[model samples]
Target: MSYENKILQMKKLLKKNNTQHVIEKEPILKPDVPNYAGIWQDAGLKMIENDFGVVFLLEKHYPLDYKHGAIYLRELYDAFGKWQQTQNAHPISLTDANNLIFYDTETTGLKGVGTHIFLNGLLEESEDGFTLKQYVLADPSNEVAFLFESKFWQGRKTIITYNGKSFDWPQLQTRWTLNKKDLPPLKEHDHLDLFHGSKRIWKNDIARMKLTQVEEEKLGFTRLDDVPGYLAPIIYLDAVKSGQPDALLKVLQHNEWDLLSLLTLYVQATNLLCEGIAEESATTYTNIGKWYADLREIDRSEELLQQVTNQYTREEAVNAYYHLGFQQKKQQNYIEARKSFQQALPYLQGRQQIIALIELAKIFEHRDKNYEFALEMTKQALKLVTESSLWTKESKTLRLADIQKRKNRLERKK
Candidate 1:
């Protein structure tokens, strides 16, 4: 308030004397950002605008004969009869390929509040063929328009995805919460998340059940010059700041590749459910057999399990024998169950051996009513508890007491 105040007062007095009045300076407004869309016109990103805001749309059409991998694009439409035989009906009605949309998403992060979807890629079957459409969020602020425009599930019945049930769709739900007022009412559609199907089919066979790995192994095609998915968030965030859409263009291609793979993967996964077990691997036979058993399709389960046990011996498919025996037990086919469990005995040890012996004992006691065999099995289990060092001393003592009781019951029955 000392010398500086005096200088400011003199300056104000001189300025007022020089000018009759001081005009009010207008407030500065930020100019609209240009060239984010323009830079990608060569890359086929079309700026589509509506009431919500602007979204960058990139789309392509694959002809019917165009093959993504080993599968032609037409297989998605032509595989209807086989699709009808799949478990994808009822809950989702996957038989209707006409009402299908193959969907995938790339996000800023894995999960939680700050994570947002940057790309939503969808492929739909049309009369002409397959059309892949990718909607991009040019900036985080325009998420409303991005989601609004990319609600490709609006009229579709079932949306197929790799992991949309857990990750992608939940991210969309978070975005909808942020922009609910501007968005149209959400519609109900059955989700046929094929990630589960792939796991069921190839989890034991493949080391990692990642989509890219599956595409290379099962779909018979490897992605060339494709941007890694983990780098998507980084590439996109940099593009947002630098306004360089060139690097982001590769990410868009990665997304397109994902959508196309989803279509072919669906065809492959559905085929597994429909095909005969005779042509499948022992691993695939066991897998699909277990799947059928879980669905309570007893006949199909028994048939597939029987095939494995017939073709492969106990050492080759010990686990298969156990599954077959259990499935046989469920059907009250104890005669066949006894044979399978006996085959499993050679592969057993420790607690597993003890448990299998107890199961065999029960089959003999309850089904065969052979108390002598039951007592012998109980003695074997008792001997392990006392002799085997696989378990702790205290655990052995506890299990020893239980086996003693079982042996006493069997002796009394004998």
Candidate 2:
């Protein structure tokens, strides 16, 4: 079947399967299945009630020095403070831990309106440790009560997540929009999605950037017998249909690990951004330096990239020098930019080499008023492009035309 058609059927099943205000499935489990409220409470989930419906809630607290998967939860505080000072101390009050929400959600499906979050895991800090609250949608009918009573995020100042900026939070907003009544605005707050930072630091090193993979490979955390996320939809649906939540326990554990990982990854990421963060590989420095440059943290960017150029490998130095030069050129630091481009020349070839030559040529021509040097650089790039086999037929034609024009202009001025 087409993907869209399957989604339509799934939506129907989700809406129809809820026994309240919808058609019901014949009980999938034997009559011996424990009562829903009884099972949940026995499993450490409290029965939470509101005007809309009933939801299940579970809370666990961890002391400051408690280590989960190689990270101490308390270290995040200092890391955030350093970053806050860099942002001019924007009063986030992260030390309070009440200000930040380490959040994640487990959904019924990956996309579309059919997706409903069955579990919402939020972790915050207290005086000594961290508190995690997992809100459970006991049934589809209880979604409103679950979302509303999972405390509505009244005073939190920041929302931290793995990919919540693009997925989880947006999904929440969509749920609010669809439900469309008596809901607190899924309130706006400062957001630091660690997924982006993880990519900035580990894009080249990690084969996959999934949160679990990142924590395992980069943060030295591993889960033994952890439930895979893909099973969440099926497990949740079965529990709801069969009135059996035994399997859902593993799912909850999976989510708990996710929340803790976000907390640790954020600290490491901030540490990297602020104080070089534990001697990362040269490529990490190169990538994050370029990221900082893009964020206009030029000095910090230069500091990281500087480490890369001083490293032993020529292959490593090429990307670092190119980006450092580009950032410097953007700031009109022409001399430094020229030095960076020249330093990259020994390690570059093909398009990157030609591009660097052209950039240097432009700086000499316009900034230094050295027409002869400009013409020389342009001539070298033109010759290289003319004989290069890298470009496609159409691209080669375009390159030759542009380079010839540049060479002609430089020759006339020289």
TM-scores vs. true structure, each candidate: 0.83, 0.81
Q: Model 1 over residues 82-109: C-alpha lDDT tens digits?
A: 7676543322235556677888899999
Candidates' RMSD to native: 11.1, 11.0
State residue 176's C-alpha deviation in candidate 2, in Å: 2.1
| Candidate 2 segments whose C-alpha is farther than 4 A from its true place | 1-34, 84-96, 182-185, 330-335, 363-380, 383-398, 409-414
What root-mean-square deviation over C-alphas does model 1 reach?
A: 11.1
lDDT comparing candidate 2 with the true structure: 0.81
- In angstroms, give how far residue 147 of model 1 lies from its true place: 1.0
